[model samples]
Target: MRRSQRKQEEPDLGVLAGRTLFGLQRELFTRLGEVGHPDVRPRHGAVLAYLDEEGSRATDLAAQSGQHKQVIGTLVDELVELGYVRRQPDPADRRAKLIVPTDKGLDHMAKSDAILAGMEAEHARAVGEEAYAEFKRVFRLVADRHSGR
Candidate 1:
């Protein structure tokens, strides 16, 4: 059949991925706001999602998030201004600064973890646990391909 004559029954992979990511982020941020971290946004996920409980270097966050160091720095700055994180000297490396979560950030992190778990559980329930597990496995493989993992 010619392209114009063919029916578009389903979205392509890129569309599906974009839709999924946007939907997930929308739900996450909305939930976060309800829990009092209204300043958290999807763009901050690059730093927030990869942050460690102790602390993390901006460079490390950049590598983990697949963002540039400068971008990570900017996000850290924003988070700092939002009172979610602070820059402190790394105990292991005096020359480097670590992005440490404030008390508010810690609370936000804990809430975020619970919310994401609940979301995943809901998805698993909808799709069946085994199918959801398989879906995650496949998605991870596809996503990690770009990271050379």
Candidate 2:
């Protein structure tokens, strides 16, 4: 069939991935709102995604999240004000500060983890665990390829 003549039944893979993630984030934000974080937004997910259990410097987070230092700094300030994250002097370097998740942030992380786990379990049940595992492996391979690993 000619390119123009062929019907497009679904979005391309990139669109599918972006839309699916957006939907998941919407669901997460809604759940968080229900759990007492009505102010949390998907934009903050960029900062939250890079934060570790131990903590990291704002520059590192900005690099990982592909955001400007000023932007990440502002987001960190907001997160601090919201009680989701705190800035503490980095022991390794006093000149730098580490962005650490507060107890509230960790609790939110736990809840978010549970929500994703439930979604994964539901997907596995629908697709079969073996198939789901294979899918995960394939996805990882694709990611590794993109990362030149």
Candidate 3:
């Protein structure tokens, strides 16, 4: 193939991957909402997921979530208002506060996990199991490399 044609034919894999992942996440969140869960924005979900994995200070969550501290603090305030999370005095630093998920937040995560499992099953069915497995493996490899892990 001519160099121009070869270059033209090269896949925009990054864009494709981003679109697919975002679509899947949107669909999963939509299904979750349909199941009567409050409409939490994707950013809030990221915050909740992060807190679930490891409770951290608002600044840490801001950095990890790629959101500004003000943005994260606002989101945390919303979560607290919704009774999904709480801010407690940090033992490591008396002046800092740690974000912790409430029982409600944990329960929401359990429900979200079930919804995500169903979505994953559908995705595997749509893209054959082998393809899904390979995609996951390759994606993880790329992620690990990018993160220097």
Candidate 4:
């Protein structure tokens, strides 16, 4: 079979997931740029998406974001420089620091939440709410099963 013909076959789960993730990230970052966060890049999502309002430790963020601790540290430093996050002493442990989002980061987080909701609504509308819900449920189950979580 020709390479072109092989390429035309239905995509495997990895290809489909990667393509979907790419599209979602592109749309999300573009929308975020329009909302006064032009400096926020797709890579920043690794930190922002997993962050909590109360703040979290670098180790926790690294585990949640599936990024190396060094990478998380670099991203946190960049965010601090960008005025999106600040490091504060962890109340529970004076020896540890917590990554807390600034006001700008909170605003960005709200906007991102709304934009993602709208995107999900659009998809649900296109494919029916029930079907979309089922798709998400199945996808999450498979993801969890593979991740051993």
Minimal lDDT window, size 10, model 1 = 2-11
State which candidate has the highest TM-score: 4
Judging by lDDT against the true structure, name the best candidate: 4
Report the alpha-carbon TM-score of model 2 versus the true structure. 0.85
Candidate 4's TM-score reads 0.96
State each model's CA lDDT, in order.
Answer: 0.93, 0.85, 0.79, 0.93
Which clashing pairs does model 3 show? none
lDDT of 4 at 135: 100
Whole-model lDDT, candidate 4?
0.93
Question: Residue by residue across 1-149, what tens digits does model 3's lDDT show?
Answer: 98667655874667667787789779867876777665676778657766744468988887667678999999999989888889999889889889988887777777788988888888899999999989989988987776567
> What number of clashing residue pairs does each candidate have, in the order they appear?
0, 0, 0, 0
Report how far off residue 89 is in candidate 4 (Å). Answer: 0.6
Worst 10 residues of 4 by lDDT: 3-12
Across residues 1-149, which tens digit of lDDT does each residue of candidate 2 receive?
A: 65434435555666666887898898888988888778878888778877898998999998877789999999999999999999999999999999999998888778777877888898899999999999989988976776567
C-alpha lDDT of residue 10 in model 2? 50
Model 4, 18-107: lDDT tens digits are 999999999999999998999999998889999999998999999888899999999999999999999999999999999999999999
